[model samples]
Target: MSELPAGLHDDQTNSEPIVTAHSFLVQQADLEREAAEVLPGKFDECTYDKGYIRQPLYACLTCTHPPSNYQRTKPDASAETAPAGMCYSCSIECHTGHEVIELFAKREFQCDCGTARLLPAGEGSCCELKSTRKMLAKFANTKNSYNHNFWGFYCRCDTFYNPDDEAVMIQCFICNDWYHDRCIGKAPDEGDYEDYICRECVAKHDVLRCIDTTLVFRGVVADGVDRQVEVVDAEENKAENTEERPSKKAKTSACRLLPDTVSQPMDLFMVDGWKNDICTCTGCIKKIETQKLEFLLDSDEIVEPEMDDTRGESLYESAMKKLQGMDRTRAVDAASAYHAMSIKLKEYLRPFASAGKVVTQQDISKFFDEQKQQTH
Candidate 1:
């Protein structure tokens, strides 16, 4: 047995095969548990009608290729297909076979799947599009924003994100784009901050500069080190995000809370609960109002992991809970039988482990068949 994938036991000699099978079982169970923790909700219903709630989104690369980013691409004379995002149900149903990139959750976005922007109901359109359709939009949702993340890229480096990579990426609270710590600039590894305003968002919204240095760690490189903005500049009406970019008149007339000496936009790693410290004095209130900065003070603007009573329970836990609810005598008898069967199954698999052979579903079935034969 050469080197195994990261989590496998290393001390195997003759028992490598059995150990490998055991490791596989453990890994599978762990994966199930992790998935349950992250996504416990039923993804049966289309979310388009809910209207701009924060929800997990997937980029259907099958329909639109990334800046060469996610999933299987449809061949074309042009690679300029506009990026479109789908909801969880659309990802599984409408674009099942396509290479998809999980974008996690985006705030205030409606699913573009089966809409005129993605693939409408027509010949060679998305499968199941007609079945569970949200009323097709005539155009892309102007309110929905796009970044390189929609195209399966992240950070200022425009690197395609590999989830397995060891590099840590943090999401900017404002734009919701991820950034590697090193790409943004040097900062302390152990520093505590939950709300990060990326350099681009910071540049677009100059009011963030007024955040006290004592409450935030600035990801400031040299004055000339340029961080590229993935989306259009404020000069254009194109939506990167409606909130972050301001019109010319609003920009010049907005509250000037910062000192005249501080001119450039830089990353602000805002400490948790720093929102409470924002000035509410008469002058600052005018600035907040001018810039539509009331959301800054609103704690509801913060995104948190979603939970509901409808979340599904894992099979193992459901079974265990059922067993617990039974009378004591019945529970003990069932547990004992389960333990004995488990032991026998392990024994049957022992030879394979010792021989360094792989155990398949058929092997487990054969063991059960032998047990049935003995019982007969």
Candidate 2:
């Protein structure tokens, strides 16, 4: 077996040992008996078993130990003197160190074998020790209560008022913090207390408060207003940074064919393959590419022709040729042909007006009257 350190000993032999292993066994048995006496059934015989002695010592001494290491030393005693009693466990000199002694004194308890134990117990152990323990327990309970009562370490006045009885807690949508209605300066006893007020409400309040100079001096709206203003300023700055100039292609593509003269203007004109052409705009481009594929998947069906300018033009041209070949009253035939042409022109211009073309009603009426006079 390894030899014990100089000051430490494991010796089992002694003619008359000042302190023996069995002494601690006896002391522990006595302590258990005392404890059982105070509170019946509180401690049993097995409580003083070897397992109990081996546990870490929680109590400290109130005085210093002697040099001999067998007993506690008096305050005025020198290192040459032997100690009165020794701690069975730690094997250190019996005088409780500063920390251990202080804990026992403050707690109003004494270690089983120490000079410090001589100090008179304050208010007695039953009152002082038990009260101290109760106070510590209450403090721990208060800390736990504070934790459970306040959510996210924040509580509104209303929430703190009836913390134990609140059925449903309201949480802010933004910031996700909880508050009582009364905390925000609102009456808690009012109807419909179930409503939740969030950071958004504060933000809106600040915005309104900022715009009103009266509320600005109160400082209540400053934080909220500043946040909202910062957001608006940031958005504006981003929009300015991302501003883009129109491309040359877009400007050139906007040009269109215009009328050469009012008399022979092309009222109805169509691009030959406009439906097949690909659109260039971002929104239209996607559909443009897939249009042909979509058309093929759903075969096109021919529908009956409606009376339109294109149909009117073909009918009027044939009628004019037949009118010019007629031999009886050529004047009347010319007059009738002119009237038919006027009606055809009106039909063509009507479609343009309906389509949002820039043609005035006055212009259409004037043109029709001129054509009628020419036929007469």
Candidate 3:
């Protein structure tokens, strides 16, 4: 095992054999499946070399802005110590066991781990990769943008986020801020939207409201109903036979296509494949450039969902698949055992979950050992 993070060390004043248990395979498998949903990406190297780009980040409170140890947070910690974000690799390899905040994916940032940007966590730099981590001369990234999220607040309501909350929070495709359905005047029961643009972004960017209506769309809201496209087709030029019709109807600019402003403050839901339909004509490109929204041109500006190949099969899933290929008698026995054990595990965990108590490592190990003894 690697050295413990700063402020953590086991004393050897009385030498006692430290025996590690290896009986939590079932629990580990379940965690792997859950973790894959949150983060399933390459973590081999630090993303300092990648420069400023949209990537997953973790805010190391211990390394830069140490949170209060009395279960209270320091007010205005953002100004106390500069907010530092680390890439996925650095989050695991460098700041393991630190009080890190997973900032999901943030836009335009480079890893600050072990760099001069982040104050040393303790005696040395805040990185495990000593040989390779850069000691940058730069103190802090001037171009990097900061928000309430750095201080652990989010959405228009500016409430502290809690994962256990029943209310669902969705990320806006435009600005990447998380929002609750009710906060945005959206009903929680409203069917899933392909992409959501917060009201602030919609009103700020004229380009969004004025996307050329002629462009083909897979899902479009017309007359408060969704129209699914069955074929590649554009809206018919309404003025084709009129004298006011221009000689070249196809040459119309995006701004002219929908030459009307939406004065209402409401969230905009985008259709499937809406990004692909963005008018890429020279005139449209020029308009987008002038607004300093070149990031919109990059398809990756919106974080892509993890692909199946990258999200390798979990241990439980692998076991289930293998059981299917086994003989009927063996498969039946394994399936029965699996289902019974899962129910028992859920019952064991219910009390902790209900009481809002954390299920410790020791609890999991003890539960599995007791099950083994009972079975024997």
Candidate 4:
């Protein structure tokens, strides 16, 4: 028979499939044997400790070894102690195993080596020996400043340099230069009295006191810019008055004069003859007529007649009828009232274009055609 591959016999070389099956069975057996050696003892008697048992498995999970003695001596005194359930052997990994047992007994059952343990719910535990060593090494390697006074009170000075209760320091108003409070005859109590008044008050005293008059309708000069009020020269005042007097005369003549169509006898008498004649132009006449119409429209008497019989008619209807029969002056007044009403109605209709009511060119042409036909 032909020799099979290395480590195989001719009978075993039936096929590659047969060889693989045998190898898998051998692997399964080896795994089962290794598992039996590492797993916990099934029987109660087999589980008993060879040495003294400090903690139950469940409780041991929650209990950590005490922190190293060195961490206990920290200034803050808030060091975290070694937690429980961490295996000492896993933590130290010493080759001799002697150091492992010694640390295990010293740290109690809390060390990682002595027993298998479960982590308790919400409890963080660690091996004492390794954790303590880490803590000690951390403390040894760290450098702390000796110059600081960690408990000192905070200072309000700009430099923030802590000073004793009576130490004199210069107080500044605007510039950075300091004056010793005692030397300047100023008290520390004065500077400490307010938070923001020092530099501001000295620079702009007037602004500090100037009361806002928008709400009260009365203002007070608490603080304003420092300014000198110069005395007025009598000669200069007289010259200013002379210049202002002529402008006043010119303004009165231009703004106060009324056209003859609207002016009363008193107004006519008040204006110069030349102005009265010049005011009779067509433009002046139209302005006068328009004002007269506006006056009638605004007058309650025109709308609310004294007679009860005419009061029931609409103002526009009654005014139109009045215009048809009135003299030139009253006709102008009534027509002006109608014109004003039309203008107002046009303004009211203008916004309707924005609300999908725009009048197109065709609509305008149609409206004008209808009006022309009605006139005929």
Candidate 5:
């Protein structure tokens, strides 16, 4: 069986939907079957004991009081301890109204009486901290940081985490934050994943394979001596790539410019002349490569596996010797997306292609554009 590339693996997402751009190609029944195969069982329901023991941050279920370790005692003569604790809202919502006993700060756990289904249904039974959904059994706050909004959890981007069932999300092994696959520009194919590390961690280590190859090495040949040299001057290296194209002078600017589509008066200016120009930067080159891969996948052309390209592999290995810690994780991501697109595109456009008419580029482009819009 083929294995996922090193440093790239699928997350254990439980019952959450795996959102892919190509999902529209599959039937609803087929998706449900796939989900069943991966999940095999229902999502584990959250409980008071589980949340209090595991989660570091939590708020009262009945009220808006901030998360605390105050535990309220049961009013019965037996003096049995309530499983959880509550905040100010829990008192007004049910505790005080029900003549519940005073709360004593228990350093170990919070008040869980709210989770026992003690309060009668109505205004008092509703929890201010959680959703009004009828199925919610326990209150939980696994968020690394606190936020007053409905989205309690936070992504690595430092933004509130919003769950979108239609967007594929991958969990980072280092930070444990979930990020949408598209946002990261790296997504896995349809398969079980066991681990993953975010780009931020990889970037911080300065190991990402994103170097200007043209500026690397330039040396004179010597007699009987194989000499390796490192070039230091940035301008000297930059000029080497530009010397051949003296007539095609690139516009030099101190600030980054944006296209007219995105307007920001304070920061960016619309550069109409440079709009059509192509960038040969390392990042842009990778973008072009990914786009070409996408194009090939959409066209139903054969996408040769990267492993089959010996020459390219040799070059990659040579570059890795020069640029240490380079991995095939990005290549694996690209390949996965390519294979998925190829399969889904072929299935979706088979009818149109077999209708005795030539399918044009516009037809394919428009079809995918519509599909992407629908997903959003």
Candidate 6:
């Protein structure tokens, strides 16, 4: 302390040491400035929209038995995927134990693996021959277009037609079936077309003769305005029956369920406890599920791929290049600072990776700016 050591020269005139403890502070500041310049949000970026997704074709995945009389049970509350799109036969055989999802007749997809006919012949064969009706077959074969006519246009003339058919067919709201204009005694454009019924159902149900008619619905979710059930209590029914017999000439509209929506012969029968509730029929319920899937697909909610390491000049590379002209120790210090900054950028981007969001170069630049602000 009294005298300087051999290699050290004490100069009262210049007191500052050659290498100070905070000497690298200037290098670190330069690094942050350069980082701001080099790595502005530099990651790959993409945005997703639902309009690009495709609607799938018709399909079923269920047991194939004859009389196909049974319907699938309601979906389980805990299950993520709702079981829809099964045939009456499939509901009884393969899916009896599991909660059954409602099924709709799809326009494009064929029967899934669960169909009896699709199963191995020895293990599970179709108990009854599948329907060979030309219209039904045509509808099942539809591979594209998801319009209302996806089920194929069947005319009472025993012929299947398309939208391009020369003869315009009118759809009977009663049966939700199409009939050739000529078959229903209608001209191509001329007939009181407001309301119509297929000749078959009209005759079978004696629709015109009955003053009061009731539609017994099954598998219908009573959600929208079109699907609410009109409940007539026993007392109300008796009171209404005794009150009035309307004039014979007055037209009595037939009572229909879920008008303007898909209806099937199966809907004619009612299931206990389903009255005044939503229609949970396979077809209707599947439609609901399909719409939801379509929305999710459209939203582009999936995670994106990770950013490549070799992408344009990385922050580390830039730092190395900037520090090359400096002293070895200073270069090493700058590189360490750059490494710390890179680690921070990675940490910030980690959450995006988990969320399936794309991290781009622009994101990196923003991180640098934030780091620069915090350091200052």
TM-scores for all predictions: 0.57, 0.14, 0.56, 0.14, 0.21, 0.22
Candidate No. with top TM-score: 1
lDDT of 6 by residue, 227-302 (tens): 4333324333334434444332223343322444333221132112222223334443344355442221123232
Q: Which should have the higher lDDT, number 3 or number 6? A: 3
Candidates arranged by lDDT, highest first: 1, 3, 6, 5, 2, 4
Candidate 3 local lDDT, 1-376, one digit each (tens)? 3442222233445265322223345457667778777667655566666677888777776666533421244453443566677777777666767877878787877667767777445544444444444446445566666666765667887877788878778788778888886565533223323577776776677667655432222223233343332222322311221223232313345334366444454466654445543555557667667865666666466233334453457676777778889999999998899899989888887776565554556887999999999989
Residue 210 of model 1 has an lDDT of 65
List, residue by residue over 281-357, the lDDT tens digit for candidate 2. Answer: 44333332343222311323322112223222233464666666788698596887778886777575665445544
lDDT of 1: 0.63
Off by over 4 Å in 2: 1-152, 156-168, 187-195, 199-201, 204-376
Tens digit of per-residue lDDT, candidate 4, span 224-291: 32122212233343333343222211222233333223111100000111111223334434444553
Candidate 5 weakest lDDT stretch, 10 residues: 262-271
Each model's lDDT comes to 0.63, 0.31, 0.60, 0.29, 0.36, 0.37
Model 5, 336-364: lDDT tens per residue? 77688778777766665455334445766
- Candidate 1 regions exceeding 4 Å error are 1-38, 67-79, 120-134, 137-139, 189-191, 223-260, 279-294, 299-376
Q: How many clashes does each candidate structure show, in the order listed? A: 2, 7, 0, 14, 7, 35
- On a 0 to 100 scale, what is the lDDT of residue 274 in model 3? 51
